[model samples]
Target: MFDNVKNNDTQVSELVASICRLASCMEGRGDAAQREETLHETLRLTYKLEEALNQRNERIAYLDRLAMTDSLTGLLNRRGFQAELQRVLASARRFKETGILAYIDLDDFKQINDTFGHACGDEVLCHIARVMERMTRGMDYVARLGGDEFAILLVRSQWQDGERCIEKIAHEINSTTLRWQEHLLSLKASFGIQTYDHNSSTTNLISAADDAMYLTKKLKRDKCTLSAAE
Candidate 1:
């Protein structure tokens, strides 16, 4: 009887040991599954972060383009053009070459705005911008300098080529017709051309070009008044 009771107690102890070993195996499997789930979540978050960074970079590029470009005409704005001009001038000095600057003012543009309407004036300006862009080379710089004024920077060009370019630009401006609200609007531009010297600073070159443009405007006005009197 004693031996039988001892044998029964031994069997019970073996059974309890087997149950504990099985429980420990299940707990280890559960821990491994939780670790795998955490790893997947971390990978998903990393992917989302990468996508956000790419989108932000694209937005920054778009804004930079907008800042450099004019909203209405799609040409370079004054600031952008000036920066380009400076760069060109620096290159020209390094190469010992000449560049040309043309100052263009739309003749009687304010009258068009006042008589026709602001909308018509805007159309005219856009038309002129397109014409200038079409006439100039890809390397050239064209910009609107506020209101009815525009400027062009021609690099590595001579005086005669500059004159020819301005003449062509003037012809295009004179021939362009803007039709708005059944009204045909004609336009003209007075230009001042100056050749840049290596010795002259950018500001001085711009001033010289501005003076020449004013002189041209004055001459054109005088001629028109004289013709009217005749």
Candidate 2:
């Protein structure tokens, strides 16, 4: 990897040197015909060099984005999400500000995969990601923590604001109807919100939120069961 980067850098330097040499040749007091020919060749070389540079830069950018993004949902994967969370946590600690971390798990996602197919399940995950992206603020970070789990890092938000945001996210996810082929699939998500405190560790914060989410899921299921029994 290091060798590849070094080689690319060397190639760029060589191209730049070639351009400079061509410019100097153009400035020489030589035969008019020779100078004219050099000018045409220089122009062609310059265009090709510029094109090469653009392609190289674009490829580097695409690779960087892929490194940080989840292939399935186009959201930050676990590694990327953890990095961003650490940055946010550090900032919150330094500034003595508060933030919210929401852990979201899709309800009955496995059932979707079992009944429909993995492709359909994949579409549902993408739909949920889109809904979270649409509902959250620009500064808020949304990430896929693999499978049907996701995390939202809400910066500079109060506890009440966090609650409201989670509620809105849950509502939007539950309300969405994704039509795949002939089947219309509806989804619901359970989320746990935890505020970042001065003493909060990343591991504890995430675990706490996850536990809260599971509790909520259990309560919801128990309520349904009780209602059915009644």
Candidate 3:
């Protein structure tokens, strides 16, 4: 919003400068016969300038959106995610509301990239992101925190509600399959959830959720190793 306002102000300043220049030209070389032509020229220039500024503003807005979004999955990027986390935390604290923060990581995502290639890996990520969006409430926030990792914020929801939602999302993601070219790929994810605590700082909350997710991943790996040994 601030950027839009600033850009608009700049456009207005530019227009004013152009008008001043036109006024100077008219004053210095005025001819009663050509006065009408000069006024028409000024109007044409003004319209052109307005059209150019509008296009520039539209481009600026598109670039800003791209900056905030992950190009691969169309989810919020880390910068956008962090900004939203701060906002959600502030609001939760102010209203003494309960919410949940979840850190999610795709299981064996690197292996997929190595085996099938980057294109398939990207498809899987987008699939997971889309599934998450479909499973969560409209008010919830989901973001991609870099390669194969994502975060979710369940605003104004209780611990139980968040737990259930996460379980459903994780289940759906695991069950879903992606068909890339002639190959079929199954997906799975590990999730770590941290319920909102009024006293917890944003850093602590994020750390807790990340730790939980790491633990979950480790346990899964251990189980697989043990089963293979047997």
* Candidate 3 local lDDT, 27-141, one digit each (tens): 7775875777777778987887788678767877887888899998888999988888888888877888789999999998999999999988888888889988888888999
For each candidate in the order shown, give its overall lDDT on alpha carbons. 0.81, 0.87, 0.87
| TM-score of model number 1 | 0.76
- Write candidate 1's Cα lDDT for 40-90 as tens digits: 654554565455455555666676777878888988888888888888888
How far residue 11's Cα lies from its native spot in candidate 2, in Å, is: 3.0
TM-score of each: 0.76, 0.76, 0.81
What lDDT does model 3 reach?
A: 0.87
Report the C-alpha displacement of residue 144, candidate 2, in angstroms: 0.8
Runs of candidate 2 with Cα error greater than 4 angstroms are 1-61
Q: Spell out the clash pairs found in candidate 1.
A: none
Regions more than 4 Å wrong, model 1: 1-48, 228-230
Error of 3 at 202 (Å): 2.1
On residues 96-158, what C-alpha lDDT tens digit does candidate 2 reach at each position?
Answer: 878889999999999999999999999899888888899899998999999899999888899
> How many residue pairs clash in all the candidates, one count each?
0, 0, 0
lDDT of 2: 0.87
